[model samples]
Target chain A: MTSGPADAGEAMGSAARAPTGGMPPSRDRGAPTEKGTATPPPGTGQAAVGAPVITDVAGLQTVIDTLAGQGYTVIGPTRRGSAIVLAEIGGTQDLPQGCGDSQDAGTYRVTDRRDEAFFGFAATPQSWKAFLFPSRELLWSGAAAPGRLTVTPDPAPGKPMAFLGVRSCDLHAIYIQDRVLLGRAYTDPRYAARRADAFIIAVGCSDPSSTCFCVSMGTGPAPSAGFDLSLTELLRDGRHRFVARAGSERGAAVLACLTAPTAGPDDLSAAQAVTDTAAAHMGRHLDTRGIRDLLYASADHPRWDDAASRCLSCTNCTLVCPTCFCASLETVPDLTGEHLTRQRVWDSCFTSGHSHLSAGSVHGTTRSRYRQWLTHKLASWVDQFGTSGCVGCGRCITWCPAAIDITQEAAALRVPAPHDPAPGGEPA
Target chain B: MRKLAVWKFASCDGCQLTLLNCEDDLLPLTDQVEIAYFPQATRAVAAGPYDLSLVDGSITTPADAERIRQVRAVSRRLVSIGACATAGGIQALRNFSDIGDFSSAVYARPEYIDTLATSTPVAAHVPVDFELNGCPIDKDQLLTVITAFLRDSKPDIPSHSVCVECKQRGTVCVMVADGIPCMGPVTHAGCGAICPSYGRGCYSCFGPQDTLNTRSLAGRFAFLGMPEPAVARTFRTFYAAAPPFATESSMHSGGGR
Candidate 1:
């Protein structure tokens, strides 16, 4: 691959303007349109595959503005309650450009970066899941009245959203949700409608959160998959810039409307270096060796009783989990019984009311409830989903009022194989 | 008539809320099973001699002990819900320490409080037909168990550990990614590993499964730098008085019951 100003212009000329039939690029930050352009072929950003790199925030704004002009809502991070939360943004001014977050157990605070850098840091409390799956949503609404039981579907996907600064782990979380909600067993039309029409603009993390364990889960410091466009923030000669690469065709079309610099070997390698650093600096680690047998064999071990004693039985941990798919539904009726609407809400196993059947009875004890929750998360979910149910994001530990850390608990039970020494030379 | 009743003794109203939280499925479930005495859902209370009963909370008082026996006598098939009904619950913390002093330490009116010296599950005083494991059972699992029982099929809830659910969900082992403590390996599976699934560690809400090996798990927690007493104290939480958990917690403290 040759790197020169002349070649850069040629590449820029060829990559500009989308080559398909969907919503055209917008002119500002606003709501996205229902329609979207056809995606560019895959491998658009690969060196051998000709990936384009964008270098200016202002230039990036031009592309965002173009999309907004075409009637699309651009959503990203905005300041809220001392932290930058993912929300709807109107322009670059609305973004937390030079700010990052500090996350620890039960503590999340926003801090200023000395340099004015965009996309300078890592994981935040907010993940893309909040937008795609709001806390409360109406699944179906209908009349319970005679001769009329019509169920209304969820609202149409909000004006095609353009997620401006999604992280890799959050993006993967969205995909995981997709599999759960829109799998072979059943399809969630509302989820599909919103997801299909959305645009993803991902930013590669330079500084991972101390609470982040995405590297161990292979989620990433740099996005490897599931993004339309990916970005890397760089600093040179006191200048702040973003190196944007097209992951899909829609990404390439957006690039066409902006001014982008052809990335050199140094730019690409620096990006790689940042990702490697984040991976190596993981704040925590888990020892999974022989975990299955150890947990299975240790079922009657004395540990359950010890753990049950301290557990407050609050559902704080569940509320913060990214992949917890458990949900319950309820129907509320309006006066006169004219209409009934079904609402879906998150439910947790840590509560006392979840187990009731018919008569005034329950199964298991508090011990049983605690044991069931832990066992299912670590072992049984594998049988059901063909994969462990956790992504090791550490949100549960950070937000837990009781400060319970699942990684330490699992490590405690692990009886290492003869070959493996205990992780960190000590149990959790 | 198919009579149904929802009962509580000493627990947070979490399990009953689970039924209420059963958005679309709740009405359909109510159509099949009578909602006779769920105070959380309806003010219309039905007297029991019930065909089926779903009991929540624990027997923390003398009155609770007697009420449980009566509840068992009337119900054809009685099920216990949440950790409180199945184990002693967090209040079972009383089982380990000096109840008198402990109560006085926390309460301003300890003299007025009429709590039992020990918190116990309903099954301790009366026979239970089924046990739904969870601090609050997975509403889906609860539904599955009920629907299956009505149809004469064994409820297909997993008897395995939270580790199994974690693997099935493709969640990376939290113990590996974050050097945090977790109880997912030995805990039962009703919360669908909610805590771990959300990038957090598991706080066993669903109690012990059919078979549990808690000793080795305790060893692991110790290895992770949790002191022995802390380890024992952790086990004594929500299900403190249950046999397996209680016995294990006591043993961890080297204070045999």
Candidate 2:
């Protein structure tokens, strides 16, 4: 958490400038290595971060414990209710062991993975957004002082977080957030602080849900770039192993501490097949070809009304979405108006407050609200953020009360609207 | 100092008690505003021409109808608080049935009981400046409205569905996750999604949210294998007098408790 200025600047550079998931290795160097905290490698410049290593279940725990020993609070997915939710972890036992989930539109089932595979699950209900861009944050606070009022920005939290068992789609989502929060002209200092102190242990998807469309989104099935260390779980021939690759210099240092060997040829191919199977078995598809133009042009389509008829105007899709970063500030004053706090809470386009003005809410109808969300995610976001907002993790599809699939809606909008003839003229 | 009055027409007094339940803020709030006409709490009944009047309960009698008009005349601002004041509440279920039958069943002497044919919201009788909806209004929300009125500004009360608050609370959708028939999709927020957090379905305690798809949620309830009458009863709970829930509840007839 308390890295030197060089390491902090380099860590910020990796995620800030990295294009999409193309996160380059941000080498941490000469940071006064305390308690085995990624012992600064030989050269300051990039060098061999070691080859991919194969580790057993116990080695996985060693990696986790080592990260913790380095003053990083490790967070991982664990079984909570019928869902796998992210929470703080002490060791491997906190992970959702021998558990897998089956998810469809408006339906979910947590089934047994049958084997003792630790990372056998899909994207959790709670994304990494909660850890980074929290639901509610106190940006600043004001108190009445003698003669004048003083306001101070809330300092970012001090915990250095290490996330274990992160997926490829989620990694891409983090990259997207990095672009939104850090790469901008005016950086959110709080988000920058959290993102800089974060380490990701990306896990390849062995069990994807029916709602998953990361293949079409060009983000997932396997971890490619955005992580420090990428792990692929192998459960074959009564062998339980993880083919782990260090993506950053810190990852190599962590791997050196573990009881793992250099990955053999057999281990590499077995890991490839695991991702290949997951890729082929993807249940949904989204055709992203000219999607921005299609949604922008189809604003007046009757399909919006049809969708609104079945829609509940609930904010689930926006809240569950990893990339949907819309927030509103609420001013809270004390009884005598001497003390006040301004909180930034997650806001959705679906809410009437999102479109509020001096007169009233601009988008009063459910159709308009739904349109704003859909168009922003697919079309308008391209103009503002230079990329489509959706990473296609499919939390919206899985969590929607009405089961309104974004992919299906996008496909429905792709169909050309028929032209209407003049009132008294012959039908065209 | 501004004067504040708490009025009751035909409520459980739970909404009035919510003001008293503001234990921490109550003493501080009293310093700023005079508790003028709170007959329930204080014996010292200060006269009206009140700065603010919080009207609770529905207008169920002709005398209450006359009294609300008088309360509206004296108060600078009238805020109808709770479901009874905003919607006719659970008592408004009698609006669907004959009052003659209800009168004979409840009262020993039917002729002595002089009541209106239907229970109606306070807004139905007088022009209410604001309506705070909930079975018993949330303490924080009530305080917000009071503070907003004191500041002469609009209160930050959102009219979005309970599902929004439920999802924000990180509670898994009971309908989507557990196949429970919940009214969160159509009911107004402000309850902090209490029902779903405890694994129980919302009973529409805060009435309908703005632009809610009642028909869609009702259909979802039906798809979850809930009986047609059970679907109707779900919409007919705390705020049945609200037009949206009332209209949706009326679609399914017969078999009821």
Candidate 3:
């Protein structure tokens, strides 16, 4: 076994002296591209630029430790009160190493991972949204007296928050939120500042969770883009190493500080193979080709009334969704009728007051409310935003007190795709 | 001297809260209409012969039956508020199960509570100028209906199903892509289809649309693998007393006529 500073220095020097300016080779010369970096199509998953070859577990710790020294607030997965939460990490010792989690409707719990790998599983119950757009934040405050008014906008500053092991699905979630909050015609300055300042160093998932449907959403088992840097862990001799790649200038700068080697073909191929294995083993599956037509055709369908009966008209699903954007304004007056403050808060269609009118009338019954929610998420969302409002996150299914699963509902209404040719039809 | 009164019985104060919920709209509305007898908002209970009475909730007791008839005689125009007023609210779940068993199971002293074997809608006993659907009606639409009635114009509440509203909003089909169940096609259009936009299914809080095809939709529900009992149970909630939904659910129940 190698010992002391000279051996460590030699390891760094060997990586530095590799022949290739980019990725290093670690595999057979005659191997096919299947043994090389597996490239999925664009918008699916992409390999990170300048992928680094991580040989063993010690190499993984070296990269993580180097980043902590460079003034970045490194956050990674850790067990937090029955759930796996992303929290501040001091070093590799702080990771939920060799631990995995079980997630389902209204429940989430972590278990022993068997292998002490850093990022080996699918989505956790907690989403990245908890950090970006918190449940409650004071947008602005104001006090009025005799037209002498004082207003102060809430201070929303962007800190250098570095995410150590983000999943591909969550990366897509961030993109969805980007469109909702930052990319919209009216930008949310608070959300924008928070997102722009944050740096993502993702760890591609080698295993998918039972609740995961990222493959259907075309999100992923591995992060293709959006992150500044990505890693894939390879365990050998009880030491876990990572296949690292830079996605931006910032990522390149971060990579420069670490003692990672140029990625050989063996490391790249192994990472690709790991990502493929994860993709092939997705826990959930969806067939969406003819779903639109099925719903449209079944309009005036009896299923509406049938499903609505058990629904409690509670708004739990909307509250937990990453893409739901409906909100309303409420104005309250002080003791004197002279002054009032208007505030906007989350509103759900299920709440009885949501539809109450001046004539003292409510519009839609529980059945209609349930129907509206399902149709809008499945059918109408496509017509308006050109994107499904749902990210296939399964949060709504799990959080519903009634135990309603949207996936099951879709499967029950299957219809043949209109465009699919007959068995004997020739190619167009 | 046009009189306008607000009334409530047998329901959560949600519909009444809506009037108060109208922040900027409340001042203008009060300026236009007389605040005659709204017990929830003010202590004022002006005498009857009121021009308009906005009634909330259903008649579930013998006393309520007497009160509605008297209120009807005193007011020229009576508009029912929320599902409780128009469709009997969640209490309408009693329409499916025997009221005797339900009452006995829920209350420790069943005799103490004022008794009615069945919960009936406002339109059942008294004449109603309009019956807005939903657990609570859409505020702007309710305001529009009020102003329109005052102007002698027909209220512009759409008789269209939730499907049209979904089309207008351009939301994706959750049923199609995610296999989510939805009731939008047969349910009345209102509330802008809020639930689905937030990645959830509609629960049909606005009730049935005109020209509903429950038989065919039920076939689809069966196709989706929903059991007969489960489907029947769902239809018997919220607006369970409404004719189309009520009748369809009865057909699935063993006791149905």
Candidate 4:
């Protein structure tokens, strides 16, 4: 069951790079627009500034190989059982080709797109959090003797990682996480180390799922920044090509190794057209205008009761959210009482113990727990990180067993509650 | 060192086995606490008063009822583990039927059998400090409870539904995706959403979560085309006698159906 790095390398060599006809006629064309560059939105992260280049499917393999050769584990989306999951990959074959996902509130299914186009799918269940803030990590281990205790931090991963096919919303999620884990007053050393050492190759989302609201969130359909390289997949005129843009010095170096032609205006327009189509086809929307204030003000809104009725109080929404970061510690001692190891594992606000105090949990009821989660994600997070916690990835909607939509809930808060004819009186 | 003991009554030894299943934590745990009286693991029984007592199974007989009281008196903190000790286990399904008729049919000599008419949780017989809800409690959670006891602090066992674990594990919901009926919304989290990850709905191996909305979840089951009888059957699975689940199941059972 274990796939070695060499197997991935061999698969890359064989599956990718098959020469196909219908390469677009090359013509002299200037850079299409500012959108084509690796420059990110202002104040997001380090700007990735590089020229956009057009490359065929085979050229993309070169990018993967370059990173793999540099001793970085290349992690990408792959078909595992019935769903696409993030896993280590060696070649383009590991990518979920000719596949797309159908997502709705409380539903997700993998379907064939009827073409060999990679990056056709929407969000996978697995997010980049798996790479950055792992579910379980050993913090440190301690050995104790009479009147003495020695402790050592856990060893960091030997090889850094290169994440491939990351979407725009996910990039924003990573940014939000950076603010939470590393940007503020406190920084998680392990997360900082992993983030600093890793490379990110983002893919512009061209096929947004019904559960997607990234366009409304203004995070993407097309990534503006926070990547070493950004790619827009173009499949037209019986040809499959990718318009790759480098976002960093390292990205430019990697692109330089790939044999790609200078993208013509037609190729650039075609790529832009794909993103435009994706933007127009965004399946969901969220009205963020004054959302924070509205949520904060409506503490007594009856919608909390309505949502809680259907909400299982399952922490799935927080767990699948790319930016939600909460952890608890676990201590394990060896049989001799001489050795003890402390570990950190993911925790969720919906859990009873998450808000446990001297007396009991603060938010004990399901209604209160759900309210706390939604308000924090939409409102409180803005105050904490100077940005909304939700990147509008819509994982909360798709993974929710009860099909409770955050957009609907937020919208519900805006409508004024029906006034009771008399306080504590029965409806007239 | 803190002294810990494990006791079992009338049910499967699955919950006790979960403690042994913690191969990595068990040895390390022993370093901090002495395994005072775990008959399943060793014959070397250490006498109480014990620092902590983890009781498994349900009170099914008069003798078992008396034993729990003695256990509660001896242990400083008595915690119930698994669905049986917390909510009477799957055997509580007999609460809906005639126990006398059931005993006569199963036993060669019904007269010789001395059993309570109802299978009841240990909490019904004695004041329990805490309860770990699961058919066979999760090993990781059991470790948490044990360690918390050693430290004289509260264990951080989540009372949220299985949906949270499913989300954290990035497992798609089987109920929503394939129209499968799941108890994930009302069942306590601890199994790590194992069934749902495998593309099946939760069977509620963990008992009812805190403030469970069983009516709403049952309504969803009906909307998904599950019959009333099947909906009732689902709740009556592992923790049939649990208050919330019992009440919800009876609501759909159509009065003695």
Show model 4 residue runs off by greater than 4 Å.
Answer: A1-48, A420-428, B1-6, B17-52, B107-112, B138-153, B167-170, B176-178, B254-257
> Candidate 2 residues A1-428, lDDT tens each?
11111222211232332221124323322222221111111112432356889999899999998999999999999887867888899998888899988888877667897889898877788798988878777867889766887787677678888989888888777766665665554456667777767888989999888999888877778877667788999998898899998877788788898858899999999999999999998889998776666676777877789889988887888889998877767778777777878777677778787777778788889999998889888776666555567777889998888888988988887665566232112211
Once superposed on the true structure, which residue ranges of model 3 sit more than 4 Å away at CA?
A1-47, A53-73, A105-107, A328-363, A415-428, B1-257
- In model 3, the Cα lDDT at residue A211 comes to 61
Q: List the residue pairs that clash in candidate 4.
A: A48-A247, A315-B164, A316-B164, A333-B28, A334-B28
Q: Highest lDDT among the candidates is held by which one?
A: 2
- After superposing candidate 2 on the true structure, give the runs of residues whose Cα lies further than 4 Å from its correct spot: A1-49, A145-147, A418-428, B255-257
Q: Could you tell me every candidate's TM-score relative to the true structure?
A: 0.56, 0.91, 0.54, 0.87
For residues B1-257, what per-residue lDDT tens digits would candidate 3 score against the true structure? 46778889788878888878878888777766777989989996778788878898988999999999998998988999888899888887776667778768999998887768778899989889988877788887777666665655556565555644553343443443234566665677688889777767677888887635565455546655678876676666677788887887877845254
Q: In terms of DockQ, which candidate is strongest?
A: 2
Q: Give the per-residue Cα lDDT of candidate 3 at B135.
A: 73
Q: Encode model 4's per-residue lDDT on A130-169: one tens digit a residue.
A: 8888877787899989899888878765688899998988
Q: Rank the candidates by lDDT, best first.
A: 2, 4, 1, 3
Task: Point to the candidate with the largest TM-score.
Answer: 2
Query: Which has the higher DockQ value, candidate number 2 or candidate number 3?
Result: 2
Model 4, DockQ value?
A: 0.49
State the weakest 10-residue window (summed lDDT) of model 3 chain B: B170-179
State how far residue A349 of model 2 sits from its true place (Å).
Answer: 0.3
Docking level of model 3: incorrect
